[model samples]
Target chain A: MTKKPLILVTNDDGISAPGIRTLISVMKTIGDVVVVAPDSAQSGMGHAITLNSTLYAEEVFMNDGPQKEFTCSGTPADCVKIAIREILDRKPDLCVSGINHGSNASINVIYSGTMSAAIEAGIEGIPAIGFSLLDYSWNANFEACKSYVKTITENVLKNGIPNGIVLNVNLPNIPETDIKGIKVCRQAKANWVEEFDKRKTPQGKDYYWLTGKFVNLDGGEDTDEWALENSYVSIVPTQFDLTAHHFIKDLNTWNLND
Target chain B: MTKKPLILVTNDDGISAPGIRTLISVMKTIGDVVVVAPDSAQSGMGHAITLNSTLYAEEVFMNDGPQKEFTCSGTPADCVKIAIREILDRKPDLCVSGINHGSNASINVIYSGTMSAAIEAGIEGIPAIGFSLLDYSWNANFEACKSYVKTITENVLKNGIPNGIVLNVNLPNIPETDIKGIKVCRQAKANWVEEFDKRKTPQGKDYYWLTGKFVNLDGGEDTDEWALENSYVSIVPTQFDLTAHHFIKDLNTWNLND
Candidate 1:
């Protein structure tokens, strides 16, 4: 019999959120699962790491599960760092983060705590994937994404991800039968037009709540936004290397040294 | 006289840091400057935005500079967002972040609050550059890089940065006379080997502090790490889009749909 792969599971919406719980359940079926996730919600955290603070990671037995779980008092990236460097006995076969309560598609990936965990793992030279649902509510139905998630996870385990790359998978908020299969796509050129909801405190001081409308500026049919809009699960092969190689030549032309 | 370009200046080391004061001084020579920076140190904040908290921007009179300044109670990314959305009367011609108290070269960009502010501006369609010094002390001699900073800032203004790309510029900590010129380069493949400083609290509870030694694994002479080591200022054209376009075809071959 083939040995079950050791899978490291994590999420940004804290250890007890339904999204991670669903991810944990799926990972348990395929591996010797070890979960090290944030103790509280860390949505929109991006790639933040703890530097100026102390971190606490305590083992906890939540539900009747075979997985060994710990709740970390740090950002998602910190959780991945601590897990790989201190928690796990050996490097796991794969690292997966999130069945996130909202979409981490397109520009959202830039501000996503979910994808940040996966990116942290990728930086550590581990194959990783971050999964998200289009719905944002805590009670979003993550069950609809199980089989698709499993298929993608198994494929990653079998084929192995390219070095320096991690997967950003987003499922449309639809039933299983309506998910028009998974489409390999690119991150669409999209952004949030922030509308700060300005309000005053009791002492007449102004404060702002960041609220924004996501706008998909790209019309490419091969984009993740188009895939999700068409009821298909989108898989954008994301990278952490932020270098714009094509423009490096143009930058060299500048009279910088002169 | 041609209208001076409206320049937005910000940093992660709080509004009072010498690094940003130096940046503000340099920017003042090139344009009408507006300084909107974090109220306190927010290093290693990455691309995090203020989503869960209320944002406060208070006008402050710091040093004797013509630059309009505000101290923001948010991360570096939030400073950029609120500057563009609420503070600035018009979209600034350019956004410059940092003269960061440390090197944001190579993989360090992934966790830099300095770069995040510049990247946030880039995402908002503003030409941006993030500047960093190799020194990591509060009193690091930022004066040595002033002329070079002016040179690079002028070059960027003259030749507008390509759409969707921001410059990540790092200067070696050397006397200005000994500086070996500037080089446009790629981000080096490098990472930190984290050593969690595990300890017990006074209450006997276990806690940890994250510490690491950077290891540059790449041998390429054309990387930022190489340039910095060779006493050259490095300018890496950075991008916000995380798509791994080269691997899309390979990912399509996976049995994801099947």
Candidate 2:
């Protein structure tokens, strides 16, 4: 028999969140599981790491699931770093992050802790995926996502991901039956139109809460936004490279040496 | 007479850091300058935004410079968001972030608050550039970089950056005479090999300092790493779209729908 794959599980919503708990239950049926996750919710952390401060991680018992777990005091990216460097006995075959509480589609991916963990794992050369439910509620039902998650995870394990690339999977909140299947897509051209809600402190000082409205600037039917809106799971293959290679020749033409 | 270009300035290093001070000076020579930066150091903050807490920004007098300055209680990305939304009287002609204390070349761009600020500005359709010096010290000499910064900033203003693209410029930490000319390049493949330094706290609980050695994996001469190593200022045209377009076809071939 083939050896079971070693799977590393993590999330941005802390180790004890129901999202991660559901994720852990799903992973256990597939492989030998180990979890290293933030001790508290690290939403909107992007690709942050704990550089200026020290990190604290300790093994914690939170579930009856067979997966070994450790709670970490750092960003989602840091959890992956420490897991690879300190916790895991050997390299994991697959590293999966989240059953995250909300959407990480389009421009939201740039500010997501869930995707950051998956991205960090990808940088370390592990096949990685980040799963998210469209619902942001604490009681968001993840049961409808289980079979679909299993199929995607199984496909990833069967056929390895390419270098420098990882999968970003976002599921619609509708029932599994209503879901229109998975669609391979590109990230939509979208952004949050920020509106600062200015308020006064008790001592007459001014403070602001960051708020925004999601705007889909791209009308493309082949985008992640379109997939999510039409009740389909979106699988956008994301890469770590930020370079705009096509524009290099144009930039080089500028008269800079003078 | 044409109006002087409006320039928005910010950095990962706090408002009072010598790096941003030098950046402010260079920008003032080019346009009508306005500075809004974090009140404290926000190194390694990545693309993080303030969502869970309140933000406080206050205008303050930092020096005898004529530019208006506001010290903000948020990350570098937040500074740009708040500036565009609440601070600036008009949309800036150009947005510049950092003469950062260290390099944001290659994979470092993914973890850079300096680049994040510039990227944030670029997302708002502002021409933007993030400048960094390789020297990671508070008092690193920035005089050698002044002329280059001016030239690059001028080029961006004269010839606007293409939509969805921003510049990530890293300078060699050498004397002016020793420096070669600037080279437009691609981000090299590089990553930090993390080594967690485990130690005991006062009460004997274990903690760790997240530390690492940067390992440059790519040796291509066209890469930013190679340019910086040869004492040339490197400019990588960076983008926020994370999709690996080349992999989309292969991903579509996956048995995901089943």
Candidate 3:
């Protein structure tokens, strides 16, 4: 018999989040699952690590699934770090994050704790994928997305991602069949037009809550935003290499010595 | 006579960090300066935001400089976010962050609060650059790197960074005469070999501090790391497009439907 892949699961949503529960349910069917996720929601945490405090983890039985689980008192990236360093006996074959409580499309991927955990795993040489639904509810409908999740996860395990790369997958909130299949697309050229909700504190100080309208300036139909809007599951093969290779030649012309 | 550019100055190392002070001094010679930085150190905070709490900012007088400064309680990225939204009267002609009290070269870029601030600016369609020194001490000599800082900042203002990119510039800790000039380079193939320093707490509970030795496995001399090691200012114009474009064709070969 072929050895089952060892899958490490985590999320920006808490360990008990409906999204993670559904993710765990799907992962358990494909592999020997070991789940290590945050004890509470950490939605927009990005890639933060808890350096200012102590960390502790506890084994918990959350469901009837055969997958063993643990709750960590840190960010989603922290859960992956602790799991890879202190929890797992061997390096996991795959690390999957989220089934996130919200969309991690376009510029949202940069601020996403969910995608950050997966990206962290990719940095550690583990093939990782972060899955997010367009719904940002505490209770999101993930039933129709399971089979597609299985197919993608299976493909990821079979083909594996390249060095320094991970997958950022976003599913639209639509009927399963109505989902017009998956598209391997690029990140849309987009940004959030931030509108800070400034308020006077009860103690008589001014403070602001960040609010924004996501603006997609790209007209390209082959982008992630286009794919999602058309009801196709969007998969953007993402990398941690931030170097803008194309601009090196231009920057080199600068006469810094002058 | 041409009006000097309006330069937006900020950092992750807090408004009073020696790095930001040096950056402000350098930017004064370039243009009109506005400083909006975190009120406290946000080391290792990568692209985090203030979603759970309200952000507060206040104008503060610190020493004699032409720049106007504000201290905010938020991450590096958040400072950039709010600066654009509520602080700046016009979109900044250039955004500059850090002559950081540490190295943000190679693999460290992913974990850098400094670069995240600059990347946040890049996402907002602004020309931005993040500067760092190889030194990581509060008393580290910024005086030694000032001339190069001025030169680079001027070059950036004179010739703008292209759309969809920002600069990650790391200066070596050597004397100006010994400096081997700036090099436009790629990030090296490096990985942090984390050696968690496990220890016992006061209650005898085992705890750990995340520490690591950086291992640069890439022997390519064209990388930023190689430039720095040779005592050169390494300028890597970083981009946010995370797509692994080369792998898209191979990924399409997968039998995803089955």
Candidate 4:
């Protein structure tokens, strides 16, 4: 019999969140699961890693699942690093992060701790995927997410992701029956038009809270944002190489040497 | 005479760090300058923003450069957001981050707080560049970096960076005379091979310090790692779009829907 794939699971939402808990249950049906996720919520952490401080990871029993779990005192990227180097006995066949509480599509990917964890695994040469639901609530329904998540994860295990590439999968927050089929698409051109909520402390010192409305500027019908808005699951094949290969020729024409 | 360009300067290193001081001085020679940098060092912060916490920015006098400076209690990305939305009188013409005390070359860009600030500005439709030196020292010499910094900044003002893109520029840590001309290159495939320095706390609890040796897996001479290694300053035109456009066609062939 073929050996069950070793899958490393993680999320930016602390491990106990329903998003990850639902994710954990889905993975248990497919493989030998090992979870090393942040001990607390690390939302908006991006690709941040702990450098100047000490890191602690403690094994814990969230429940009586066959999967072993550890709570890590670092960002999502740190959890992946510690899991690969210190915790796992061997390389994981697949690394899946999230089932995150919010969207990680378009410009949101740059600020996503969920995508960062998956990207971290991709950097380490593992085939990885980061999954997110459009719902941002703490009690958002993840019951609709399981079948889609399982399908994608199984497909990934069957057809491996290419080197320097990972998947950013964002699910629409709708009933499972209402969901359309999955669509592979590009990241949309979008940005948060930040409006700082300026307020004062009790002592009258000025401070601000970061707030914004996401503006989707891309008119492309073939974008992740469009797919999600149309109730289809979006799978944007994400890459770690940030290079704008098309711009290099134009930049070389500049008079830098002269 | 043309009006001076409004330039916003920032760094992941704190406002008082020599790196930003030099960056500020160089920017002043080209434009009217404003500095909004971290109050404390925020290295390795990646693209993180201050979403979960309050942000504070206070006007501070750092030396006698012709730049108005604010020290912000936020990450590098936060510094840019606050600078543009809360502090600046109008939208700045350019945003330059770092003269970073270390290299943000190759895969380091994924974890760079310095680059994140520049990227933040780019997302907001401002032309941006992130500069870094190969030397990782509190007292790395900024003298050799000034002329190159000035040249690059001038070029960006003259030739605006395309929308949805930013520049990741890394300088060789050599003398000014030893430096070759700038080379526009792609980011090399590289990553850290992490080694956890496992240790026990005073109370006998286990902990670890994250450390790693950077491994350049790519031998391509057209990469940022190659340019920096050959003593040329490297400028990688980077994009925020993480979509793997090449692999989308292949992903669509999968039986995800079936």
RMSD of each: 0.7, 0.8, 1.3, 0.7
Any residue pairs clashing in model 3, and if so which? none
Taking the candidates in order, what DockQ does each have? 0.90, 0.92, 0.72, 0.92
Q: For candidate 4, lDDT tens digit of each residue in A90-178?
A: 99999999989999999999999999999999998899999999999999999989999999999999999999999999999999999
Better of 1 and 3 by lDDT: 1
| Model 3: per-residue Cα lDDT over B82-107, one tens digit each | 89989989899999999789999997
* Better candidate by TM-score, 1 or 3: 1
Clashing pairs in 1: none
lDDT string, candidate 4, B28-103, tens digits: 8899999999999999999999889999989998668657989999999999999998899999999999999999
- Per-residue lDDT for B97-170 in model 1, tens only? 99899999999998999999999999989999999999999999998889989999999999999889999999
| Candidate 3 chain A, poorest ten consecutive residues by summed lDDT | A49-58
lDDT of 2 by residue, B133-160 (tens): 9999999999999999999998888888
Task: Give, for candidate 1 chain B, the lowest lDDT window spanning 10 residues.
Answer: B62-71
> Which residue runs does candidate 4 get wrong by more than 4 Å?
none
Q: Which parts of model 2 are misplaced by more than 4 Å?
A: none
Q: Name the candidate that leads on lDDT.
A: 4
